[model samples]
Target: MNIDPHKLTPRARNALSRAGLLGQSTRVYELVQSGEICYLSNIGTKTYRELCRYFGVRCDGKYPARRFKPVNAVYLKQCIHYLRGHGYTVIEPSQSHNQ
Candidate 1:
């Protein structure tokens, strides 16, 4: 399956944006390069887990609730990248990425 680069779904974009991931293209690129953000294979889009790993947040699986907090744009980008890398393609707002 081929993915059209021109169109990205609203849901996909929103997921990234709400997580503080979307913004000026250059800033996004820079954040990605600094290892401040990463793509996650499990969570679909840029997720808090990636950021946690980046920030070295300790977790013993005792508190799942505390796992997500202080989420930022950098983490969201990682989620998007993660989804894309795992054979998921962003098509349109109404359509889901094919894995």
Candidate 2:
């Protein structure tokens, strides 16, 4: 699968920025270190589902689905950890080192 940076919507971009993940690859890892997120081993690429569950959203899909609106910041942090444990590495912002 290929990921296109340009395909990311403005909202997604803003979310990434707020999470301090903008223009970086290790942001997910950083979020984990911050104690703002947790990882679950069975979700696979459905990290979003884990987040939705965290927010108490229920799914009506046959395969067990959940929906979350506007995506919560705290949930996104959880997603970062989920992604990291699944072999996705996030890039930390350069300035994060000084702080």
Candidate 3:
């Protein structure tokens, strides 16, 4: 399917870039599929620091990678469902969808 990045807002572009970039990986795969929805696979941000530290991997650290979970209603419901299902204490909105 063809998707338009320009249609997204600046904030959404940032968040989706992270998640969609991860979804582009040959080595990595999506945990949950929601049509064209985005998900970050335990991977940290691809910043220089994150590259040196997590290397797109998931692990415990002070500067851990974050996912894009929108505070908006539709995305909020989805993010909360996953977080709650998995048992998270502090239910914050997502950038990682589940980070």
Q: Best by lDDT, which number?
A: 2
Off by over 4 Å in 2: 1-5, 29-99
lDDT string, candidate 1, 1-47, tens digits: 22222343544345445545554445434433443333322223234
Cα lDDT tens digits, model 3, 5-96, are 45434443454465444334332223222211222332323332333222233433343333344546677677657755653322344456
Which candidate has the highest TM-score of all?
3
Q: 1-99 in candidate 2: lDDT tens per residue?
A: 322346555444444445445455344434333323223222222443343333334433423312221145566567766667655554422344324
Backbone clashes under 3 angstroms, per model? 5, 7, 7
Preferred candidate (TM-score higher): 2 or 3: 3
Give candidate 3 misplaced runs (Cα > 4 Å): 1-52, 56-67, 93-99
Model 1 residue 52 CA deviation (Å) reads 19
Q: What lDDT is obtained when candidate 1 is compared to the true structure? A: 0.39
Q: How many backbone clashes can be found in candidate 2? A: 7
**What TM-score do all the candidates reach, one by one?**
0.26, 0.25, 0.27
